[model samples]
Target: MTYLRGLARSAQLLGLAVLVFCAFLVTVLMLAAGGMVFGLLWVRPLTAYCRALFGRWLGRDLSVSYRPEPGPPQPDEEGFYRHDSQLYHGPRFPAYFQRVQWAADDPATHRDMAWQLWFPLVVLLVVPIGLPVAPLAVRAVAAWSAWMWRPRPGAKERRRRTDAVLLAWAQCAALLLSAAVQVALLAVTLACFLLGFGLGIVFLIPTGITHYRWLANLRRQVSGWGGGERIERPYQPMVRPQLRGDGLYRVRNSLYKTETWADFNARWVWVWHDPATWRDLLWLGADPFVTGVLAGVPVVAAVYGAFGLVLPWIWTQAFGADWDTWYGAVAGNRLAGLVAGVLLVAVGFWLPPKVLPPVSRWSALLLRPTAKEQLRRRVERLTQTRADAVDAQAAEVRRIERDLHDGAQARLISVGLTLGAIERLMDTDPEAARRLVAQARETSQTALSELRDLVRGILPPVLSERGLPDAVRALALDTSAEVTVHGRLAGRLAAPVESAAYFAVSELLANAVRHGGAEHVTVDIRHRDALLRITVTDDGEGGADPSRGTGLRGIERRLGTFDGTLALHSPAGGPTVATLELPCALSSPKTSTS
Candidate 1:
């Protein structure tokens, strides 16, 4: 069974390699035809799919998110707008050229291209090496297991028996099961190849895909048994049937816009070099062949022994004819021959169960992350988080500058003009001068109010005075929607984290009222361990996209500073939920006043 399982896994891996190779060829052809710019329309989606596939293979999520470009800036409180004139109104360039330029400029696109170039090398290295190495490795593991479980000279009888039974059952079960699966896969693959030209293509795609999926599942199962952590891929995008075009249109779209071809190219060039792929290749070569040989040899011997020995003796005795006896008179007994056949069949079934565990263990070794790889991944994550923090802080500073310039500064300038007019009028007309003095006083008061508002916008006084819960409560009260707050958070968070959280919540609520057309909203905040979780849910016409809106992107950037994450779930035609998670420890509780 272990041998069979190994063979099945190998077939799946080989199939994947072929698919990737085909994709690479298509991508190259497209690129040569100058479709690289429009190719990105397909490339981005293709990259996402590859990330998902990698996650499945590795048994973990490998999601990488890209921020959408910011849109034109909107007016501030003082009715003045800021714009990047060059970005929006640069010298005339072709639309296709612009798109191509954008794709070339994107780091994600570059990474994908690099992966495409890297995939072939992995396939060339892993396939040939894995085929021979896998079977030997499985055999070595079986040998090691037997040696390890061998009874010691001073071992108790019961202890020896227990160890023997455990070793026997695990090995046998794994082998039998894996072998059965491999034989089935072999049969299916043959059928697909034979019928592929006619009815085969239709069945081949689905069957081929399912075969690999099961192989991946087995890998995950064995890894878990060996104490390896499982990683899940994030949800891949789903096509809505209702939104789909007609058949003709769909085909045209596939040719013109769908990333299917580009996906093929990316997948071909990037899928083979990973640990999961190597392990899968190992399973393909070892499991099926070992199980077949071990189990097949005995079954063949049983049938031949019965015919050559027992059958001749039986015929000679029954017909009263002289015949040479191969196995003495016992070979003439029909009942004995039947009994031997049954025993041989039973042995065939028994062999696999005894051999499977060791092979599975061999595969498991490949699935586990090496200590070096784990450290490398950790360093990469930390580096990215630090960069995001710096960028977010810079953006915040720019925002503060904009607010002060547009709101408080503009109001102060108006007050200064009014005061100057009053100075010119004071001696010429006493009554008019008195009126001017009162108007100037009013103007100065308005300027002071604007400054206060600007300062409050920067950091609300309520937040400093009472902390997050009270500050959020004030925010809810200020909104038009019927907002409900659920869950309790005690004590104070670090000032920057708290501020980011508060504003993130504020932005969601504002979006709910203004863009979402929501009537009711719910804010749930809870602290668990060293992290704070905030969820804002609203009954609104959903379709909230960060790419289309600067507000959500701003919130994401702000939260990124604290190693935080934001997930938006807003499908069309209904409710939206924005979840925020931040890693931080709370400070001592603010003193409560009655």
Candidate 2:
């Protein structure tokens, strides 16, 4: 019976191979004939069939792990459905496009295409032999199918290492290119200075100084890419030329009727007088030699060791070809050459991870802002945050005023009018007077409720009384998503700090539920080393950008006022984490309800 089953399995495998080949040809032809949508549609069913066959052969259930299809679009307050910021009257087109994008972006779709192309070829090669070899062929094909169809455990780590090596090579190429660019820019700088000082053409000076600023800036950015300290930009903020009341723009003692010349002159003076410009020029002149040696050593050693030494040694030993090239032998000995070549190759691989960090630090020596620049930058930031705080306060006041006018205040006025009516009716009609009194009582209750709600909006009662930990728990209770809070503070934070943190957490929770489509969230709050740290994490489709949303920027400004910082790590398909840190001492422990 076992022998008969093997025979049957062999026949089935051969037949399945032929069938898959035919499907593969059809899919290809459909794709070639301008039917990509149809081709993609054809792939899923084919993958399902193959998965079932493979699973039957392997004796386990195979599963598909495609991303979940997006649900139907919900209409906004204006009764319009939104997809990627584009509003539509109906959901049909948006749904269709979204589905198309979903299919295109899915990794499973590509995996299916790969299986369709590769599986049949493997089966045909293995199963074409006689029955004696058929069982072995079946085993081979099953293993191949499992590897191709299932996710590999080490794939992510391997991919990361591959990416790192590729990035290192790319950085090497960029360094060499930048060295060449530096030499060229040094010539341009000299020409600009010569023209401005020697020939009296002042405009050329700013043009040349500003031109190389981008290269220096790019270096500053990439310096931090791979385990390196980030170098902040050292240049001062440019001041715009201000117009005077006398219908002229002023730059120092000089004034011009039109704004254009004054602006140009200001830029010229700004670039000329700033010490950073000279520093940048000095860096440019020095970088070509310093960075060139740092970047070129590894690449040159690897290339020379592998091609120049190792390959020639192999050729001479294997083929007995007495090639008399100076590069092939080290000091007239092939054995010595091979050992030296292996050592050089080892050095090449080992050097980049060690050297790149030092190179970045070297760049930071000149590129980082000086003490004066740091102080100035701090002052500017404080000024901006103060302005934002003032504006926010003004807006909050307006909101309170509007709510009172529209809600509680209006209700109170109606109650007063009703009471006056009741007094007038008491003597003439007793029944109508009693009804008016009941109406006025209901109106007063509603007005009181509105007043409480408005106050709560200003500062939540839980936050003010219980402190941050309990306040966060109260917040979690209010949100629709499941939230888990961890960690404990020994005591309470300052009132203002607590308020800022509570509101920030509230906003994050709201965003996670409404925008992120998250179902679960975690909030961790702990204080250590005189700093209070809070982290909000959500398992959501995370692509949060501060530039795209005002909520994040508002949180930043609020935190900045207390000398705090907010850091966000949100990848495309991920669990988003937003961390908030504030430097403050905690008071004595508060009595806990928990």
Candidate 3:
């Protein structure tokens, strides 16, 4: 079976080589029929189509390829047909489509405008290509040509472009060298064909393969190292099948399995397998592509050739002869190589992607996720808050009960006892009974004051009657901190939100008065774009750490329950500002019963 399989593969590859030769003839006939420019015009679209098709193939979600033909029963494999959350949970094709549409490199919009683009290419194709230096076309010409030298953001893409040019030059150079050898063989006898054939097989084939592998390896070296990734071997002889226990049930797998199809066809082929000669023939079909780009592409090639090639030659001729004798130039040759190497390195590396790393790092420095993620992680924060509110109400109820039982009830009992005693004395002293009633009235007044204080602690009366601004003003008036309620907060918030806001403000005012030791302070509230922002700033000896006490901690807890945040910016010697940001989603409930 192994012998038959290897034979079959060899036959397939040889047949593929013959097919490529035939295809090259067909491509030549097609180009001749259409004329070179017309044929050339199609290459960009074909290249773009190939790129997009391969990109889509690559960008497909990674699929697991299960093994053992019909497959083995394993615990992990049992879940293969089961839904993976990453594949199943989120939105479907439309979501990915929307993401791809919003992607920086998506082709959807370009597809919509395709009609507008190809018409110009079609018009240019109908005529002999021109490289006229018209002033109007100068910017377009410069931009398009300069694109080749521009740094692609991904190092892989940059290497692809460079290697493509190198591969073409290598192939063309190989063909010329091989053809020269063939010509030399022709000068000899027909018997030399057999000898020449042997030489080509022994020498040219291996050397061509080595040239191919070197170009392939060079791309991997630069791209992998530059991108800071693990580099795989660019090419290797296929490893034999691994033997299982008892040297039976041999299993063979490709060293690097393709995670996506595009890698298999393009990136994969480069990294592992060498493609057949059909790919080379198809590449030959692209000569019109090269010729057209050279012709219609202005003095782009000329500019690259002149400054990139000719000007350097001219400079060498001009400057290299500074010394009369060649021996005298040898002493300063190190300086010359140093200058040349510096220029070469600059030319090699300086471009757009290299220019942008500083900006990327700067943006990364300014924004951080630690605090925001900390808030997001509190799971049952809302439940804890509502429980606290209930506890506060319960404590208020107990205080009210104690005040009534001790003060009012006791005063009534005393009044009864005194009145009874006075009734006995009523015949003798009616004024004594009146004095007992007056004592009960005084106790009643005290009880009322205590009840009022308890009720206010549960929910302040000022919040229910006057809205946030007025309630805040009342706190400010009572505060020892010379407080200024600065900005106008015109709109009414939902009552619960307003109540939360009111209490937060009230607590701050009380703290400022008692502890902050400030001469002046400012409170400002504003409603903008469905967010209510309240800022309280104080001019104090201000090293106010919010985490030190429950005053700010409780305030933070309240804000977190509502998916809001409080930030404190207080420095040691002066002003302290506390800013609160919250969503204005408060729909008022009839919460007065509690």
Q: What would the TM-scores of all predictions be?
A: 0.43, 0.63, 0.36
Any idea what lDDT model 3 has?
Answer: 0.49
lDDT of 3 by residue, 1-594 (tens): 244443443343334334434443444565578444333233334334423432333343222121222222223333432223333233443344333334313233233124223323432432223223222232232233223222335688878867754443333333334334433333342333345466653223322323333322332233322223322332333334433545333323333232333223333233224332222222223322432232222223323443544445445667863432232222355345434444543433333233223222321222122343334434445667667667655765888788778876776677677667767866777787678667767766775676677677666777767667777888788787788886555455666677678778777767665677878889998877778888998877677787788888777766665667787888888578888887784233343322
Question: Which one is best on lDDT?
Answer: 2
What's the CA error at residue 271 for candidate 2, in Å? 0.8
Model 1 misses residue 32 by how many Å? 92
- Candidate 1 lDDT over 202-288, as tens digits, reads 435334323554654665555333233443321122222122453221321343234554444333223333444444445555656
| Candidate 1 off by > 4 Å | 1-273, 279-378, 590-594
Candidate 2, residue 268: lDDT: 78
- Candidate 3 lDDT trough over 10 residues, lowest sum: 61-70
RMSD of 2: 15.7
C-alpha lDDT of residue 386 in model 3: 67
